[model samples]
Target: MNNNLGLHETLELHELLLFKNTCLTKANTLSEVAQDQELKNILKADAKASQSEIQDIQKFLS
Candidate 1:
């Protein structure tokens, strides 16, 4: 990935990566507290997807 990102672009990607990490954490925490089976399942799926997105963003930043 020859992403010769400028300072602004790098900062934006870092922010996005941080947001994804936050989302993953929130989903995991909410899933633990959620009583409904359906909601828990949804949160688990969201956490998994967030992890994937975070990895993708990291690749670009790297």
Candidate 2:
């Protein structure tokens, strides 16, 4: 089955991957300095979402 995306879609996906990576990095940094459980949980959730987005981007690139 053909799975190639248009150029615009590919670029958009690339941007999303970059954004997700950035968010994951920020989340990790925040997690280390997080004093409250709620803050930590929020960062953890953001990191997870970023990871999921990265996976989706990978699939699209493939």
Candidate 3:
């Protein structure tokens, strides 16, 4: 990859990591007060997706 592209990828990966952390935090918070099962499920799915993205970005950065 070009140097500029690599830099962009790195920044993107960092952003992904931050986003994933935010999702995980929201999921945990919702779990504590969640009354709707469907909502909980959706939040869980989002957290899982974010986690998967983080893993993919980490692998790409390596």
Best by lDDT: 1
Give each model's whole-structure lDDT.
0.92, 0.86, 0.76
Residue pairs with backbone overlap in model 2 = none
lDDT ranking from best candidate downward: 1, 2, 3
Better of 2 and 3 by lDDT: 2
Better of 1 and 2 by TM-score: 1
RMSD of 1: 1.2
Q: Tell me the lDDT of candidate 1.
A: 0.92
Q: Give the CA lDDT, 0 to 100, for residue 58 in model 1.
A: 81
Q: All candidates' TM-scores?
A: 0.93, 0.85, 0.70
Tens-digit lDDT string for candidate 1 (4-60): 888888989889988999999999999999999999999999999999999888888
Candidate 1 residue-wise lDDT at 28: 100
Over 4 Å off in model 2, which ranges? 1-3
Error of 3 at 45 (Å): 1.2
Range of the 10 consecutive residues with the lowest summed lDDT in candidate 1: 1-10
Per-residue lDDT for 1-62 in model 3, tens only?
23445776778778877877888788878866889999888887877887777777677666
What clash count does candidate 2 reach?
Answer: 0
Mark the 10 consecutive residues where model 2 has the least summed lDDT.
1-10
Could you arrange the candidates by TM-score from highest to lowest?
1, 2, 3
Give candidate 1 misplaced runs (Cα > 4 Å). none
